[model samples]
Target: MTTPVQLYVYDLSNGLAKRLSLSLTGKQIDGIWHTSVVVFGREIFYGQGILETRPGQSHHGKPLHMIDIGETAIDEDTFNEYLAEISQHYTADKYHLLDFNCNSFTNDVIGFLTGGSIPSWIKDLPSDFLSTPFGAALRPTIDNMFRRPIPGAAPTPATLQPSPAATQAAVNASPNPALAASLLQAVASQAFSPSASVNGTGSSAPAPATQPQTSSSTSTVSAPVHICTNPSSFHSLLRSHRAVIAMFTSATCGPCRMIEPVFEDLAWSKTHGVGKDRVAFVKIDMGVGLGSQVASEFSVRVTPTFLFLLDEQKTYEFKGADSSELRSQTDLLLFQAFPPHPHTKLSFPAVEALSSEPILFTQVPALDSVISKLASFVDGSSSPSETVAAKEKLSQSFPVYLKARFPANKGAQPPKNLSANPQLIASWAEATRTIASVLPAAQLFPLVDLWRLSLLDQPIATWCSAATSQTNPVHIFMSKAIDALHTADMSARNTVLVTLRLLANATSNTALVRSLLSAAGHRAETTKVLVSSLLHADASVRTAAASLAFNVAAYLQKGRMDRLRGDSSAAGMEVEEDGDWEVELVSAVLEALSNETHSEEVGTSFRAAA
Candidate 1:
């Protein structure tokens, strides 16, 4: 449902001078009042800021004007946290008579909450009041009026409001795994809180998406907003995030600076509401961030220019600094790009509530002995010698230093730091990184299979942070498997491919696969590996490759491979007309379908790919 944010306009002067002030300046008088933002009908940050001056007297005795600033991208919990962060800057100490006051604080809150600034005149009233010689003379009196000491009272900011730019991290790391994940899921799915416990062991079966999302909460990107302060990042942004709002601004432009608050307000301060997928807001200061030639490539001569793009195609273009219109049109652009999911009808309350209850992977991880034994065979040097007898003894005793002990419950306590995997996962990645060159081609696939199982046992939350990382064991193992998929031994090749297929089924998540492929630092190459594996001689390997392809295609269906679709050459590979390897992979699946009619298993996998 569309939940419009509430904006409160309080008239401090109560219209007493509106009739008189209009005659003085010939401008319409809207009364002198305080402005504030109220979410869900309660004002937590403001109103109290202005209470010292107005008390019970200057309410205007009128119904506070409420302006709907479109649907909120924040939930109540996150909204409360965000209020706290801005409150640091909007403290009572920061209030000024002619510079920063109630109106300024309200504008800040409104911008933070809904990414829409309050009315310009409201925000400028104090400055406008001071500009007048009469009001300038009265500034001291007004300041004294607001600065009056409260009788036996404390400060408001000392008590309420703040965001740490880390709500996602908090949610991901909640003590109650279900609660934290439900909180995030609530933003998108609006699901109710879930149970803390999960049942069943891990298998080559897809875990439920709405289970206790505790495992995956271990990973998080601090903030979604990427400040595009330069050209290279801007170019990269163009290729990623299916839906992007590019606020083209300049340092010297007055209006651009004016609406820059809008950038601060609407940026990724919040990532809930209708949809978080493929939606990104980027601020490109064209003057400083993009050079003149590069700016011309985007054809930006004007400041405050906005480009609304979906799937790399421009959907809307406009030049304006009007914060409201900019926001409304951006909302419209998000609507055009990502329409509301059909699930918004409120018909499935049970299902909506269940969206937070993710079933975690509870299967026991592989024993250290298995990993140690697997490492033993592949730990040998590339050139063998009579010293093999001595080397075998050392390899036998070699322990797998990169083994982690996963908890039965993902949200049990302090979550494991896959990002800061200084030992186990890092050692695993190092072993996989050089193992291919060290081990014979025939044995590489079996070694990779063991590595895959070791990683597969890791909770999805361990590897899938909100960042692109290859240092994690899951990524390194996949990178190693990319080599194993092409080994000369059909048995080893099929084993590695089948293991990938099994892992894909075990966790039907896009973040895991994307993170794995993201390890190689190039999506096209990893994609090529998945596609090239389809041409393997063994039908089962090809089928497993196809199954892996099918699994990843589900990731594509969700727009996870935004990196694969870009302007760069495909590392000298053949480019399709549209230049998406995703298309080529799909075509390969179809071709395999035509040639292979015998195996029911391969056909079923191909059908899933189709």
Candidate 2:
């Protein structure tokens, strides 16, 4: 799997670059000039002055150091937005020669990403200058340069980097006493600076400082409490979440309005502490047309009534504007939900984005040519006999080919040179798509065996950027395919699990993620199947499930924060309840991670993911 975190460091001539005027003529400076964080090799996260973290392009110098900060908990969208929020103060327009520069931005980003920061030297560079006699004398010139954005740099009003949702870095350093002592001595030796002793990258000398300097991570955003107008929809919300506190009141009721703000605040998704469940707080205006009917259904006769629902069933109800009673019932709601899931909680954005980038099919004939062979079955222009024969031929021959290619021989391997066969991983994906497009469970099952074989392992189950195939027909048809798999024979069921596992790791494209999300109508049941498969009796199936857990968790962490901030584009995303499929999936993963009875690989994976 690709590393989720990397350090993109750039040295502006190590204190002797284009801004030399500020360094030499203005203030004495030490260490490098700029640095940034890169996540999933997909985006460059750095402070550029003003608010815009340069999108995907990297104009900065080659990274001097690329540290693997393990898999990050936050996704790119969240990190980017965090940068946007941080610009409130860390604007490029306010760039300081020594004080708040690119270094500070990097520190803040590291904090957000891994709950760590660069060593003190990198962070306290300005402090170093301020402490010196000459530093105080040159403050004006340095501050002037900082206040003035470099001519070619970001225009005024650009800013970024914020502190939020963080914990101490989990980077593991070797436990060598000498190394530890030397590191302490090194810090002591650098007596000039007490603010920070780690290297510019937060690495300790004579030792790779794997431990990221700790920093506070608190997100300033979360999904707002929503309004429910429809009665059935509100009931569904109650049933769907672990705890839902519905505020029932009419427009004519004064207490409802008085308690409105408080309800909104309490309903907010962020509770400011670890694992606090964000209750579903909803308001029902009974004075409206549907309110009275809803009131009758819930048997509410009083104004300012609060209904505490646990698992779609109401366990408690409060009447009147007594805020104390309302809060007490909410507390009872949490108490029943119980167990207090700290980190291993339902994060819906992560659930929604649990997909690999689809491998874009950019090649022309390579992609189309393969589909050409099977497209005939879909169009029905071919004679029924021809179609039947083609299916049988594929069913019989493809699996044999896969077995030969991957070889059951444990020590056997695919050719050093790649396959030129049409079933080369590239053509296989096209074939899978063609079969899926051909439609009808009866027709597709014939080839499911072959498809399943392709997913077994090795050089078989995979794809390459074979053509301009951005969309996977399988992804689009996944729901139906999964539904079909459920009723199929044991082999077919196993095959689907294996194929999904392969897809999770095999493609570099997001087509899979897109398909899963777009077909969200089917996600609940589908998620259930996958989560259940994690504990299947089949060892291979369990292995596949575990791998998928990693992928799902990684993908989820990348996009969660943005979704929580109520990004309009992510409007309908909802966190699953305690027993919900998504919640079960996360809990299963966390359990597997903590389960010492399991294999080392699973335990290690969960620990890393954590």
Candidate 3:
């Protein structure tokens, strides 16, 4: 038979030592050497020692002596006390002792505790542990000792590993053999702690011996939290449970004036939990103000931008406005803030849908005209076929006309009074009424054309301005227009590519433009189309397509990687589960277009029919 070697009690915590005593027998004997006991705590040290017995003594020898291997005096009395306690508890009958002689104190202790046997391999070790397998190998042995029975006791039944809750409780309890054994059993059965208890109980274990909390008030905040001023902070706030709102506005924004009352109402409602926990509405003025730096950090270019933040971070944003629309938006945001019940249907007034049909204008009127000449033209056209065709053409061209004719105060300064003009209000109402009248007939055509036109350079400002009106008709028209424009046809698709280009070049509509690209169906094109568009004559079209394609590809890759992460066999699993790598396709196209060998810059503008 192989000679017995030195014993190791590796990685022994108080709970683990107690568990070993309760579970094992014949663990202590003369001539056995105990070495390398790794204790994970404030102090990290090792001990070298030997257990000696008389030469003629049999396995049942009465006398045993512990000799320190190191030159320094060993605390033999303390060591003997611990051994006697373990021996009396564990009931080790006959065992041979060996002198301690090993590089690692931990390995020796583990070897002794686990019957001087070592497994051929250890599996699934953490990276740090794998770097030093000896330490890692001992963890399982210590773990196994807690799972077994002593010599005279009934063998512990084979069972699943202890649950996190049970293990935590065991670790937290005072070091008593019986208590440790009970805790280990509880952990194994997964009945250690209740869900609420687990969350409420601070860390995995009860407060350690060194640190104890008498009450909730005694606990100190972990860190000094600081608010972020960028888009990342905005996202973080949205995800936070804390109630707060980050309002972004400019001093001279007209729409901001119209919506100020609504914000005040929101703030008031929050105080009563009418909004719950009373929202912390932090106003960040985009104009010259203390928050101007924050606005600049987030690249804020538009005024009246209301960022609905939670916990002082941005969650949702609102810019420009119609009173009813803004009110409805505010209500929806409030609903999100409160959430009646998990299963309850969320309630908020529905905003008007986007329009699909284009407004036909046979005659171009002055910029300030109150009445729409197109309405009379549609009513009076003589030929039925001609009228229908002209109406269809007008529907197509109206968006373009609106885009081209929208006014811009290029050299004018910002308006002093940030309030809506009565004339502007009247014009919006009239325009809405005129557009609503034609919506039913316009539904027959694809709404993509209307959207395409609205995105055009001149029409974008007009569309935005008109859509910002609270008039029901105008809201309805803009909503229907947006709906129609949601999906694109072949020609309209190219026009969209062009529209993106124009918006990117203009730079004023940064937020609006980003929202458009984020909408559905925008990332569905083939790589060829995307790459080809990169060299298109229009600068706006090329840049927009390129940026969008990159973003889409990045989003897809991230989503795929995230999906592949939790499972054990994820490494061998295929990356594309559905075989639709839309992002990858776009990326390939971008790569091809960007390669100077394959493509060149084309200087033509995109001009597909609306």
Candidate 4:
């Protein structure tokens, strides 16, 4: 049964936007759009993650307009499955007013359900807001409004609104087990947050994207907290940070001036785990004002003095201008603050040397052939001829967009924004979903090949790499390929080869890689595919399988190394699961190596995996 899909659009400004937008932004905006998809007897939206309510029953009240974009053949159970997959990405913390908002979520959902999009006037509002002087000026304010709560301000009505999933046990749980473990350790040691409860949630939203400029610091680059004239502010910093590295200096001190830059650089070094809420670097100018009072309290008499505090207790103090010593002591403090996994102490030189670059099969086939093959697949399906037209449109326009965005010259830099025509994006997404669903596993190579090339581009990769997308073409395609691998057919073998290449390209997104590998059933199926394909009769299949193994191994190896260095960025899998993964991967590689004879290429790839 085809279910009707309606786009329920609400004006967030309550009709004030139409009255004031022109004066404020120098643009005549229709309304501030807050949209939801109404389908399968429910109104679905993204706010505090994926939410659903009875049609016309949401707290937003009745929508200003509801457009019947189209209908979807997707059943209720399948749609729920889709929701479960995409929910993690659409958390309340991830929501933003500009870069990714309710409209973005609706657009993704609409594209999946009906192969259509939300109205352009609604979809283009964020960009339209950004194009104006007032809007551009307010970008930071808008971001901060959503990113963090104002200090000491009363909670707003929106903040107090209960999530629909508040009753769910996992609502308060950390998605990643390793992260939860780290949090527990930090809480137990009273190093991370002394007052923070084990179940508490804090604002760790990513900083908003800045407008294009000659230079701008990214969200990862953090500035040191300064306590130039305030002695009281130092205590707050000490309470908040797990470890505080305070540099006490005076303006007149020559050595103090020399080491200020070094202190600032340490705060910005992401490799040192400087950013986020993990560690804080402070600069205190004690030459004048209450800075002298702070200096007196700490009994700092030297021109350049360093104080290292863990959980507000002084662990180390030094009086000098030694840059190397500063770095070494900072590293030591962080190591104590965040101890490494025991696995880091073990040796794995071969895994250490493996290339981390994703093995992308970038060879673009003749466009005419690829498109014609795709058209044939569409023709075989129950889809309309327009589906073929959409597929052709994507095949022609996507490559052009990629070329314009990423030129052949090594020095060329594309705009950070992946602002292709919305129609092209919609068509590409619809076509991918259609092809993956209708095409048999044996005949999936051409579409898989195109997808592999598409993943090389940032926009497509970003969209597809989400473990659960509106359409989830990548996950669906991967599942299909893995299932087909159990068969002995030659065509299945061919499909698996291309599928492995596609998997390799997916490794470019670390989060996506972790998401795919972390699922127990998916990981088991993938292991079976790799093990069987490694021993396949065809050398190409074996080589492709080996290449995929290398990518997965490299990813796991890097995660292990990150943990060793006290970098929590790659912490996702549980400790036991991570150990099991290494053992299983190594066993597969050894099993394949024992039977290898026909091709040295396969051996080399397997050796890389080993």
lDDT of 3 by residue, 183-257 (tens): 335323321111110112233322111122112211111111112222333343334336555556554566665
lDDT of 1 by residue, 308-339 (tens): 78887788788878888778877777677666
Preferred candidate (lDDT higher): 1 or 3: 1
Stretches of candidate 3 off by over 4 Å are: 1-409, 417-514, 517-585, 591-600, 603-610
Better of 1 and 3 by TM-score: 1
- What lDDT score goes with residue 289 in model 4? 34
Q: Tell me the tens digit of each residue's lDDT in model 4 across 86-143.
A: 4434444445555556666676667556656677688557656654433433444444
For every model shown, the clashing-pair count is: 18, 31, 37, 0
Better of 3 and 4 by lDDT: 4
Deviation from native of the Cα of residue 459 in model 3, angstroms: 16
Each model's C-alpha lDDT? 0.46, 0.45, 0.33, 0.61
- lDDT of candidate 4 at residue 349, scale 0 to 100: 91
Greater lDDT among 1 and 4 belongs to 4
Q: Which candidate is the best by TM-score?
A: 4
Reference-based TM-score, model 1: 0.38
* Model 4: how far residue 498 lies from native, Å: 0.9
What would the TM-score be for candidate 4 when compared with the true structure? 0.51
Candidate 1 vs candidate 2: which has greater TM-score?
A: 1
